[model samples]
Target: MQQPVRIAPSILSADFANLGAEVRAVDAAGADYIHIDVMDGHFVPNLTIGPMVVQALRPHSAKVFDVHLMISPVDNFVTAFAKAGADIITVHPEAGAHTHRTLQLIRSLGKKAGVALNPATPVSVLDYIMDDVDMILVMSVNPGFGGQSFINSQKDKIRAIRQRIDAVTAGTSRVIDLEVDGGINAEMAPVAISAGADVLVAGTATFQGGPEAYADNIRRLRGPLV
Candidate 1:
């Protein structure tokens, strides 16, 4: 069965000048999770916030802190992010020397572990770590920058991962969320959901028009099918 649609407003597009207020507003506006994009210039093309920002924003919202770490040597910072109050820590396979060990380390810290797949990354990588992952983030756009266009080719990747997750968790109680990030707006959200994305990470779509329009943006992203 398909999971209920969840809206995770990305803080990357939030008003950085008043991030705490932005987080709080989105939380109150029906955001299911607070998505934080942590990037290192080495792993990704751009450099973004670090664990300190996450810790600072921790008190702003009580919702699940879905932290996506786009950094190399990800193992070194797992403990930091977990201690910083990240409910879910997502890392890319290319960022670590051993993705399996990385996931184990995250789960050991009592944080839900997830694997993020870049636009060009292959789904075969998940074959070894599917059971260990709590979520699978498919980057619909190239990672690093925000407000980029969605890569239509990724819909096929999303569908493949969804089928793999379903097969692995067929009859058990395992719940692995299929998340789609990048280029997600009200218009493109439904296409990703149709391809089996349960969690929608929208930066521009959710934070645009300020706080007043957040609720409506989320409702539109959730769509009538939801």
Candidate 2:
């Protein structure tokens, strides 16, 4: 059976002061996962949340905590986030010297592992680790900040990666979620979906009008993919 499309609201653009309430609001608004972007300034020129914050927000919602680490030296922080209640941990392959080891560490900690490819990073890097992860995150825009424009060229790349994941996981019970982050909105939802993305990550588009608008925004973002 095909997996249902998911709308994950990125909290990078949410109100940080009331984070727990914000998380609950989004979960109530129908978010499949709560996407937390962890930046270390050194990796992408911006700094954001840590495990302490994640641990605090864990009880606010039972939705999947999709943690995307945009920090360098990714391996050093895997354990911390995993213990902080992150259900899914994703790291950029270029962020560490040993990508395979990082994935292993995440899985060893009992969390779903994922590898995120930047807009310029080719899918070939996943050749050996394709089956090692539970998800493939395609950055539709460069990581760092929220509300960036989507890279048009990534549509084909998304399709290519989806095809590759299918090929590698053939005849197995393994299911790799294909997620696209950055610049995702209702209008672009179908594009990403048709290109084979099952999860859509949006920040500004999701939290723009505050919690009250979340339901309609998420509804529009889900489009006809239900």
What residue runs in model 2 are displaced by over 4 Å at the alpha carbon?
A: none
lDDT of each: 0.93, 0.93
TM-scores for every candidate against the unseen true structure: 0.98, 0.98
Ten-residue stretch with the least lDDT total in model 1: 217-226
Residue pairs in candidate 2 whose N, alpha carbon or C atoms collide under 3 angstroms = none
Write the residue-wise lDDT of candidate 1 on 1-226 in tens digits.
7778999999999999999999999999999999999999999998989889999999999999999999988999999999999999999999989999999999999999999999999999888888799999999999998999999999999999999989988999889999999899888998999899999999999988999999998999999975
Q: Candidate 2 on 1-226: residue-level lDDT in tens?
A: 2488998999999999999999999999999999999999999989999999999999999999999999989998999999999999999999999999999999999999999999999988988998689999999999998889999999999999988878877888879999999889988889999899999999888898888999999999989766
Against the true structure, candidate 1 reaches a TM-score of 0.98
Score residue 142 of candidate 2 by CA lDDT: 90
